[model samples]
Target chain A: DTAVSQTPKYLVTQMGNDKSIKCEQNLGHDTMYWYKQDSKKFLKIMFSYNNKELIINETVPNRFSPKSPDKAHLNLHINSLELGDSAVYFCASSQGGQGGYTFGSGTRLTVV
Target chain B: EDKVVQSPLSLVVHEGDTVTLNCSYEVTNFRSLLWYKQEKKAPTFLFMLTSSGIEKKSGRLSSILDKKELSSILNITATQTGDSAIYLCAVINDYKLSFGAGTTVTVRA
Candidate 1:
């Protein structure tokens, strides 16, 4: 089984539309994170959840909210999306104190 | 704020040649430095270095970190076409992992 899995490998939506991406991990990791990769391939952390508690929020816009139903799943919801929101979103998970992370294939979001 | 910078944003090398990628970081509460190889999909872990001067090796890929300089180097020897990928360097500060812009390496056959 894939350690980390995400739904909707590709998404195309109109501006101002709302969409959601789902993620899950079966590695039994305690921490899960959301990262965005822009056109330049620069990956930036957006949010993190330890177990089910929100830990890091990197000044992301209010339109983007993350919800963790449980330790194994973290979902991202974006409302009123803009053209700048067109990027690849990745979901990753890691155990506490582990230096490496297991990443999902990523969802490529296109806003037109 | 934590900053991780990778040098030589991109490079092309012939098979059997050696390539070196550099990463410098500035962060507080440094925990560990990690190297990952990214192909068309998600990034995959390569090595993790905590103590300075200890080299971590896996096949043709190896990496070392220098805590004093706050830097790390990933070396790929006997490069093959399959070695072509974007190499990402990340620093773990406390519990957060911040990634660099990544170095794209293309190994030509």
Candidate 2:
């Protein structure tokens, strides 16, 4: 079984559209995070949720929202997507605020 | 702002060779440093360094952190073609994890 998994591994959509990516972790972690990797392969943290509560929110646009239904699930929803949103979105989970994270297979979003 | 810097953006090496990747960070409330290997899809955890001078090794990959220098290094010995991937370095502070621009390693057969 996958420790962390995200659905729709590849998503291609037109600009101004709305989409959502789902993530689930079977590792029984208490914290979940969403990261974006641009073409430069620079991974940046977007949002973090601990026990279904939002903890850290970077300077990401308000159009991007993260929802943690529970400790084991965190989903990302993007509204009115832009071209700059074309990148790989990764879902990760950890026990708490320490240690290495377990990442899921990224969802490649291509905005046309 | 928290910063994690990875050196030599990319490298090309031959099979049976050794490769070293460097990472340095400046962050508040530093908790630990982590290394991940990204191939085609996800980034798989390789090592997590919390204490300085203690080497963590797994198979052909090893890593060490130097808190005095605020840096860490990942070393791959006897690297094979399968060792090719983007190596990511991240620093954890508080509830945040800041990442460095990954180092791409290409092992030629």
Candidate 3:
């Protein structure tokens, strides 16, 4: 069984369109995070949720918002998607900010 | 900002060669350092180092953290073609991890 999983493995959309990538963890962790890996392979943390509470929000634009329905799920929603938003979005979960993250396979979003 | 820097950015070597990847960080209240090997899509966990001078080894890969120096290095010996991937180094702080611009390694057969 997969510990942390995300769906819509690949997302192809046109600019100005809005889309959402869903993530869920079955590891019974209390914290979940979203990271974006760009073309240069630089991984950057976008949002972090600990027990549905927003903790770390980097310098990401306002168009992106993360919602944690509960401790087990964190979803990323993007509005007015731009070309710069084309990157692989990774969903991760950890025990209590102490353990290493268990990451999902990733959702490669291609903004056309 | 917490910064994790990895270099040489990219490297090419033979299958049997030994390569050392470097990582340096400037993170406040750094607790640990992690290494991940990212291939096509996902990044798989490799190793995590916390104490200085203590080495963590798994198969042909090993890593050591120098907390006093704010740096760490990952060494791969007897490298194989399967070892080729983007090796990412992250500086783990209290709650978030700051990642570097990974090192792309190519092990030629």
Candidate 4:
């Protein structure tokens, strides 16, 4: 079974449209994260949630919001997507105090 | 701001060659460093180094961390074409990870 799974493997939308990406983990992990990978392949952490509590929030714009319904689910909602929002978004999960993380296949978002 | 930097953004090597990838970081409340190999979709965890001067190994891949230098190195020995992928380095600080730009390695047979 896939430890971490993300929906909408590919998404293409017009500018200013809003969208949401869902992530689920069955690893029984307490910590989950959302990362963005740009065209240059630079991975940057956008948000982190531990047991449904917001732990880390990077300097991302307010347009992007992360909601963790529970320890097993974390979803990202982007408002008014722009060209810069085109990138690959990956979801990951790990136990607290652990170093290794299990990642999902990633969702590719394209804003045209 | 916490920062992680990786050297040699990209490298090309022939099969059976050995290659080393470097990662350095600057952050407060440092905890550990991790190495991951990304082939196409998701990145697979390779090693995690918490203490300095200790090396972690798996198959032909190995990595070591140096706290004094705030750096780490991942070495691949006798690389095969299958080893070609983007190597990502991440530093953990207070449970949050700051990732480097990553090194792209292409092993040609």
Candidate 5:
């Protein structure tokens, strides 16, 4: 069974548009995170939520927001998508406090 | 800045050749170090080393951490073509993890 699952495996949209990527986990994990991997394959954390509470917010732009309705779900919404937003976004979950992560298949976003 | 640096960003070798991937970190309040393998998709966890001088092994993969040296190494013996993939090294400090650029390994049969 898939432990961590994300919606919209691929997304193609125009610049200045808004988009959202949904993620859920079945591992009973309390922590969820969103990460972005650029074309160079450098992965960086964007946001982290634990028990529906914001824990870590990197230098990500204000246009990006994360909402966790519950412990099992964490969704990312990007407003005013720009060309630089095009990348593979990965959703991950863990039990928190140094637990190993289970990552989703990733959503490839293309902004034109 | 807090960062994780991996050496030999890319390597190419024939089958049965052993390879060692290195990772060094500079993070405050270091908690643990982890290794992962990424093929054409998402990365899969390999090992999580929290302490120094402890070796973690899985099949042909093995990893060990050196807290004093602030580094870790992943060793693969008898690497096959199927073993070709990007190996990522990440360090967790509190709730944040700094990932290295990753080392791409190409194993030719």
Candidate 6:
């Protein structure tokens, strides 16, 4: 079974269009995270949710919002997407304390 | 601010050669260090080191952490073409993990 999965492995949209990426994890983990990887392949944390509660929110633009309905799901919603938002977004999950994360395949978003 | 830095942004080596990837960090409230191997898509976890001077090994891959120096090294011996991938190092502080830019490794057969 896939531990962490994200929907729409690839997304191509026009600028100013809104899109959402859904993520789910079956690893029975407590903490989940959303990360953005740019063209340079530098992975930066965007948001973190623990047990469906927001724990960390990086200085990402206000257009990006993360919604965690439950502990097993964390979804990212982007409003008024801009060209700079073109990047690969990854979702990952991990248990509390001393464990590495399991990352989703990732969603490659391209805004034209 | 927490930061993780990796050395030798890219490496190329012949098969059967050994390579060492270095990772160093500076962060407050340090928790653990993790190594990941990313082939194309998602990164796969390789090892997690929380203590100093203890070596973690798996087959041809081994890693050790030095908390005093705030650094860690990942060693891959008898590397094969299949071992080619981007190695990423991450440091956990509180609940967030700060990731390095990653080191790309290419093994030629």
Question: In order, what lDDT does every prediction score?
Answer: 0.94, 0.94, 0.93, 0.93, 0.94, 0.95
- TM-score of candidate 4 to 2 decimals: 0.97
lDDT of 5 at B27: 95
> Interface RMSDs of all predictions?
1.2, 0.8, 1.0, 1.2, 1.1, 1.3
Which candidate achieves the best lDDT against the true structure? 6
Docking outcome class, model 3: medium
Better of 3 and 4 by TM-score: 3
Q: Judge candidate 6 against the unseen true structure and give its global Cα lDDT, from 0 to 1.
A: 0.95
Docking quality band of candidate 2, CAPRI definitions:
high
- Measured with C-alpha atoms, the lDDT of residue B36 in candidate 6 is 95
Better of 3 and 4 by lDDT: 4
> Model 6: clashing residue pairs?
none
Q: What is the DockQ of each candidate?
A: 0.74, 0.89, 0.78, 0.75, 0.82, 0.78
Residue range B1-109, candidate 3, lDDT tens digits: 7789999999999999999999999988888899999998788999989899999999999999998898999999999999999999987787887899999999999
Tens-digit lDDT string for candidate 6 (B1-109): 8889999899999999999999999999999999999999998999999999999999999999999999999999999999999999999888888899999999999
Q: Rank the candidates by DockQ, best first.
A: 2, 5, 3, 6, 4, 1
TM-score of chain A of 4: 0.98
Candidate 5 TM-score versus the reference: 0.98
Residue A23 Cα positional deviation in candidate 6, in Å, after optimal superposition = 0.4
Docking class of 5: high
Per-model TM against the reference: 0.98, 0.97, 0.98, 0.97, 0.98, 0.98
* Per-prediction share of native contacts kept: 0.64, 0.93, 0.68, 0.70, 0.82, 0.77
Q: Candidate 1 on B1-104: residue-level lDDT in tens?
A: 89999988999999999999999999988989999999998999999899999999999999999988989999999999999999999988766789999999
Give TM-score, chain B, model 3.
Answer: 0.97
**TM-score of model 6 vs. true structure:** 0.98
For residues A30-112, what per-residue lDDT tens digits would candidate 1 score against the true structure?
99999999999999999989988898999999999999999999999999999999999999999973566889999999999
Question: Which scores greater on DockQ, model 3 or model 6?
Answer: 3
